[model samples]
Target: MSIRTVLLHAAPDSGFNDRLAFAVALARQSGAAIKGLYTLYPAGVPRVGRALSIYVNELVREAKEKEGGLKAQFEQATAAAGLAASWETIEGEVASSLREAVAFADITVVSETPYGTVDDQLAATLPEHLAMACNGPVAVVPTGKPVPARIGKVLIAWKPSREAGHAVRFALPVLAAADEVEVFTVEEGDTTTADSGAKLAAWLATHGVNAKHRHVAEGNAGHAITNEVQKFGADLLVMGAYSRSRFAEMVLGGVTASLLVDPPVALLIAH
Candidate 1:
């Protein structure tokens, strides 16, 4: 029920160090063990020609080298943090490997993708996929920036949906630790009840979380959510990922898309 194990998608990329640092910090805060997962696609066995076989062999060798380096880095970082940690190198599809790794994890920590980079797009979308596939929270940290040492304040994007409810439940540990917790709801005309936000706040209170209810006139949901994060100086933003179908989200962007495109703060997302 608490954050006992944190799974990190450890990639040998430009943002590897940042992700490790952030994950270690969070693990320290929660007294959680860290598991670093490095996944690489195995080059398929070649049967047609020796030339193709040689190329595949070279790719596999390069992948193994990368994994070795990443493993060393993970060990060094975890040792420096004095944290209980484990590392795994798997040959499989990145998304599926992460989904399997996160099955036993209480939370997953990942770095945001570098914008407009084809190679980093997968890294960017990995958190979203994990949020949907894993039965826990996923913390997406912005790359190339120092993460907040402590998540003192949290902004929860509250909505009356099963996904939103799940996100709140998954993020309870972080919320419980925050000095200030705000349940932010965007009201669209007369559709939502005036006391809806209060109800969520009361629910959180039962779990020993003191949260304030804040409702704003419905504008762009994503903008409203991020605006609140900036206005309140929140270190963390908790919300459900992809409330709508992927196709629908692609056509008409949702809160998840907006935040992923330009994350304002560390995001704890669940689905």
Candidate 2:
């Protein structure tokens, strides 16, 4: 699908300046518009609607101030990138609104935070919950670095599975722009030991990406992907965020958890 609009989710504590920049970069390239959305976290209990009304007003007031400041900074950054990005504020759960935004746009852009960051608590777009929504491909921009306009290599954590396939599909734009696209999978003992690597490569070729299949017989799947990502000097790593359970890592622990901060490469996640 063509990208005519992009939804960039923002909140009071979003620490993803780099992600905002990346979305602006992509928007400029695609002649698309960027909408920066901020959601206010309601105060007090849901059951006591009346009791929370006054406190809710206070929360909304503070949120408005935060949004004003954030909107200014966001506009300045996007303007510097020569793209038209605008802001809007909403009141609701961050994750639900983000999903709605994704459904309404061509693609979704988010900046992932460390598993336990304050922003994660506010927006809860932390990789796991995000991957679970399954609304659209999400570009999880890494913090602490500048977003690159172009990438040299692309890493696809593949396994001939839905998640892997989705990752490839989600990364179509970035993959097409890279010099090299590599599909890599690691053995996990029991199931998925087939020659699916070649199959994944073929899938990539159909999408105009000449991906090379590479299989690693040993090492942790996430670790292997990271090592190869670094080895290839890949600018982007695309992989499915397998699970988004509160108990699972996407929100709390596993692979998504490990890659939250200073990942080997910027991750583009979809479920």
Model 1 Cα lDDT, one tens digit per residue, 23-102: 88788888899999887653224336889768656655776788887898889888988899998888775777878777
RMSD of each: 3.0, 3.3
lDDT (C-alpha, whole model) for all candidates: 0.81, 0.71
Determine the C-alpha RMSD for candidate 1 after optimal superposition of all C-alphas: 3.0
Model 2 clash pairs are: 128-250, 249-253, 249-254
Clashes of each: 0, 3
lDDT string for model 2 (136-226, tens) is 7777777666567766677887766677677777678767766899888787773564478778788668878888888888777767777
- TM-score of every candidate relative to the true structure: 0.89, 0.83
Model 1 residue 266 lDDT score: 83
- Candidate 2 stretches with Cα past 4 Å from truth are 42-58, 115-117, 190-194, 243-254, 260-262
Instruction: Look at candidate 1 and tell me the lDDT of residue 199.
Output: 96
Poorly placed runs, candidate 1 (over 4 Å) = 42-59, 116-118, 122-124
Q: How far out, in Å, is residue 182 in model 1?
A: 1.0
